[model samples]
Target: MLSDTHPAGPGAAMRSDEDFVRAQTGIAPVPFVPEVRLHMAEDAIALWETTETARGERGLPPPFWAFAWAGGVGVARYVLDHPELVAGRSVLDLAAGSGLVGIAAALRGARSVRAAEIDAYAVAAIGVNAAANGVRVDAAVEDLLDGDGGPAEVVLAGDVFYERAMAARFLPFLLRARARGAVVIVGDPGRAYLPRERFAALAAYEVPVVADLEDAALKTTTVWELAGD
Candidate 1:
C-alpha cells in the first residue's frame, strides 16, 4: 500500500461556485463522501497536496488517484452520454479511488457496477459516495486483477498511470481484459506512462482542483478519454 498524508487541523475553506468554475481549469481535490469532507473540514487538511503527514491523522486520505482528469471526465462523459454502453452491462471500476467514474457509470444506467479499490479508507469512501449518489455499486476491497474475478463487459480506469512501476504492472492486466473482449477504457491527464495513440478522442472538459490541494498556482483541470485501439 502507498503512504497517505492528511493531517488534522482547522479546515479548508469552502469555495464559491464562481471560484469553483474558475478553478475548473486546473487540478482539484474532490471528496468521495460527506464524512470525508467533514473530516477534511475539521482537520483543515487539503486533500490533493503533497504535504507532511499530521500526527494522528486518521485513516487513509484521498490520493492524487482519487480525482477525475480530462481522460476520466471524457470517458465518464462518454459513458453517461451514451447509455447504450452501460444500460444492461456489468461494469468494473478498477482502482476506483473516489468512485467518480464508477458512480458516473452507475448513474448512466449500468445494470450492475462494481468498484474495486485496495485502500481501506478509499473502500469505505466508495461505499458512502455510492449511497450518496443513490446508486447501486458493489464496492470490492481488493487489488486490481486479483483472484478469479469475473469478466466485466466494460472496465474503467481513471488517472492510474502516474507511477512508472505501477503502470507497467497494470498494463498487462488491462490488456488481458481487452483480449477477453471487454471494452476497456481509461481516463488520464497525460501522466508519465500515457501513450497517446492508444486511445481515440472522446471529449474534453475542465475539472476543478482545490486551491489548497497543490502549488500548481493554476486551478482548473483538463480531462481526457484514453481508450484502447
Candidate 2:
C-alpha cells in the first residue's frame, strides 16, 4: 500500500509530515500491546479525507501508519514476551507502517533496529512514535523487496499479505532473507494471499483492532516463522 505520490502544492509544503500526523492523531496505547503507545487516528475515513484535502489529491493510499494493525500487535506482543529472539540482534522491520514491531524489538534489547517504509508520512510517523516510546528506530523510506534482506539478523513483516501483488513480491524477499540465515518472521490475520503452508505458526493472539478498518473488533492473528529455504 505504499504510494509514490507525496504530498504536493503549497498546502502540503506548509504542513510538515510530522505536523500533519500529530494534528490528525492522538497518542494512545494499543489495546493488545499496551506496553507501547502510538499516535493513532480514531476514524479512518475522517483521516483519509483530511489527508486528501491537504494534499489536493484523490485515490491516495490509506494511512496505514495511523493504526496499530492486528498483525503488528500480535508480533509486538510475541517479541516482548520472548525477548531472546531479538535481544542483542539486529532487526529489520519491513514495510513498517508505524514502526510498532521495530520499537518493540528495541525495547526488548535489540542491538539495532531499522524500519523501512515507502511512504514518507509513514516514515515520519515512525520517528514520532519511536521517540514517544523512548526508543531509537532508524526509520527510512526505502523499499527492500528487490534485494536480499540487508545485514540484519532478523526480519519482521506484519500484515503484508493483504494484496496479491505485494504478497507475490514479499514472499520471494522473505525467502531470500531466510536463505541468507536471517530469521524471518511474519504476523498475519489469515489474509487472502498469505502463503500459510510456507510458514510454521509460533504463536497466536486475539488482537483488538479497529472494526471499521478490519471489519472485526478483534482479529485472531498469528505469528509465524518462515520455514524451508
Q: For residues 1-229, what per-residue lDDT tens digits would candidate 1 score against the true structure?
A: 2322322321211112112222322222333211111111211245423222321244544553334434445456566677787778899888876576787888878988998877544555565556656787787568766332256888888667778877876677777777677777776654678655666655454444344544342333233333554
lDDT tens readout by residue for model 2, 1-229: 3223445563453247888889999999889799999999999999989888876779878999999998888899999999999999999999999999999999999999999998777988998999999999998878999987879999999889999999999999999999999999899997999988899999999888899998988899999999975
How large is the C-alpha RMSD of every model relative to the true structure? 8.9, 3.3
The candidate maximizing TM-score is: 2
Candidate 2, RMSD to the unseen true structure: 3.3
Tell me the lDDT of model 2 at 156: 94
Off by over 4 Å in 2: 1-15
Cα error, candidate 2, residue 70 (Å): 0.6
Q: What would the C-alpha RMSD of candidate 1 be, to one decimal place?
A: 8.9
Best by lDDT: 2
